[model samples]
Target: MADTLVAHHPLEFVVSELSAASGSAVTLTPEPFLPQHIVRLPAGSATAAVAAQLQLPTAANTWSRTADGRAIWLGPDEWLLVGSESTDAAASAARERELLDLVQTVGGAVTDVSAQRLGIRLGGPKARTVLAKGCSIDLHPKHFGIGTAVQTVLGQAGVVLLALPPGADGHPEYLVLVRSSFAGYLATWLLDAALEFTSSSSAAR
Candidate 1:
């Protein structure tokens, strides 16, 4: 028989889906199934397709983006390509396949890791403060400003933390990608820390 098991996202059971506190100065919201592929770049036309300035972004810890997706520079000859958020599994898989084929045409090795991590959207004025409670990385703007992305430790979990441009409210925003197994713990930790900021949304634990 074919496999019958269906995969479920880590934050699926959370009643509130979005947690906010301190008059929205801090917020943690689930952003699941943002298709992603880890690519080991091979010299070819595919690189040009994804490159921002006719070549992959040369700046360390930066990302090259287009309207549909973005390629985050992860390391030497490697990048994480992220597609627009998608709730439909089929669509997500199609997008991943499209990218995989595109890269393979240039002999690049690309792995679909779309289900490997759970995404948490963190933002607001007190966002840095909440993250600082557990993350050791300097959250100061001069050190980790918008457009910066790094693989780091966050609240006892290994995560890819990306500093995004400010939100519509003109406050800082970030995207936290942690392994699914660690999502619950990270969510709880964030909520507890957000307490000081008048935690109110209560998305998960």
Candidate 2:
């Protein structure tokens, strides 16, 4: 069975047949800005390959493969890759060719999930609070930091959380990637939870 990844946020939502999600409202549009890039490394060569290309100061700390070639980065070398679709078809193909040439053997396998998955954005001071209601992982910038990525569970759904750079307001933004099937449900949940802060909005002014 294939799943579609979806992006859910205050700005907009995108659905695809892949398993990875990126971009967030907090990182773009109405708040701070954060760019996300998700990729799969060639099997055992992920760490070495990324090291060679990106030239990280240190080797990646973790790297694992999904049933497909979805490689995930737990630390430095590890990263998770989910196959999905994008509006820029040619660019996607070019990226695939580049990865193939940059790394070793074609890891394990690949899946054509140009249908599942979703993308969403979370920003503002209330962003953390909204996510805290469902996620056990700490969203505090002190722990998560900017440009950091983590794979964790949110409201029982598998998720990839990316911390974006600071916004114009000097507030940090966060990008949340969740499954498409769960977007509507999660959006409703987040809105309901955000109501509490509304009561205090007038006082701040």
Candidate 3:
């Protein structure tokens, strides 16, 4: 008999619900599931060693990306390494193992948390407006720009918000990292908040 496959993402059950909602002002979609490796680097770890291992950012609340993965700074000595999935299952597994080895070489502890969290992408002209309804952080471009990241609360759920490169229209895009359990709740909350904008946009047309 074949081994039981248990891998699943929280948003797998809600794709239809998300797709039915209007996306005029802000669009919400689940990011392609990927392998996320969380690492806790100890204090006093050499900056050069950490960078050599994973392109760790030098500043707090920032992220650096490589061809296959991205490294986000969670705090002074902690980081989250997220790896993109490859077409081949075996290739994906190999890439994950390679990242694990890199962190281990630097004496950092690592955890495969790919299933523990969900990635949500929020974009469109009014993306920031929709987020401001629930998030306390100042989403102004002057305060938060590409490469900025922060762990904060969004509608009673804890999340990691990362500012990605803007869209062609210069509108901001944000990647919200939420626990798997809270994925549905946050998605609903966001859609509800977005209704106001969607309705207004429809009226103007």
Candidate 4:
């Protein structure tokens, strides 16, 4: 018999509602669920071994991506490994376990945080402006450009903000990672902030 398959995505119920409110100046999309492996290596240990197992960046707040997965450096010894959700569920699960095993080999601790966090993609011409309504960071291009990632608060919710490379039309895109519990609140806050921009863009056209 084939293995039983189960699907779970925290943002499933609200994604459609949020997407409906998206507009030209600022579009929001719930990122497809992905497997996330978070690891914490021992202090003073050789990170090269861990990096060898998973292509992780040594610098803080930086991320490295390979064909199979992406790794984000959260702190001196903390890293988050994320696998592409576009792959088959079984393959993604296998990859997550493989990554966890590799971390164990390096004497590091790993946890599967796939369901603990939710992702939202906020993109378009007014993307930055929308985020600025809540975040206090200086999001100017020179200060927070591509590859930059930071933990910040957005409308009372803690989130990891990643500055993704601009889209083909030169519009900025930001990937916001928030706790599953706060996903709804953040989504609503974001949609509210984007309303003015969308309206102005429509009126100008």
Question: Whose lDDT is greatest here?
Answer: 4
lDDT of 2 by residue, 7-125 (tens): 43333442221111212322212211122234444435455655445333232322332333233355443444543333344554555555545543545223323333444556666
lDDT tens readout by residue for model 1, 128-164 = 9989988999989999998888888988899988898
Clashes of each: 0, 37, 0, 0
Stretches of model 2 off by over 4 angstroms after superposition? 1-50, 54-86, 105-116, 198-205
Superposition error at 166 for model 2 (Å): 1.5
TM-score of 4: 0.86
lDDT to native, each model: 0.76, 0.49, 0.79, 0.80
RMSD to native, candidate 4: 3.2
Ranking of all candidate structures by their lDDT, best first: 4, 3, 1, 2
TM-score of 3: 0.86
Give TM per candidate: 0.83, 0.58, 0.86, 0.86
lDDT of 3 by residue, 1-205 (tens): 9998765667777777667554667778887777777777766647468665578886998888966678899987778877766234555566667766766665767776777778888888888988999999998988899999999999889999999997665678999999989998998888887876675447777
RMSD of each: 3.9, 8.9, 2.7, 3.2
Kindly list the per-residue Cα lDDT of model 4 for residues 1-205, writing each as its tens digit: 9999777666677777667667767788988777787878875456576675577788788777856667778888888777766556566567667766776766878777877777899888989999999999999989988888888899889999988888766898999999988988898888788877765446777
Candidate 4 least-lDDT 10 residues: 84-93
Candidate 4: lDDT over CA atoms?
0.80
Better of 3 and 4 by TM-score: 3
Report how far off residue 131 is in candidate 2 (Å).
1.2
lDDT at position 168, candidate 3: 63
lDDT of 1: 0.76
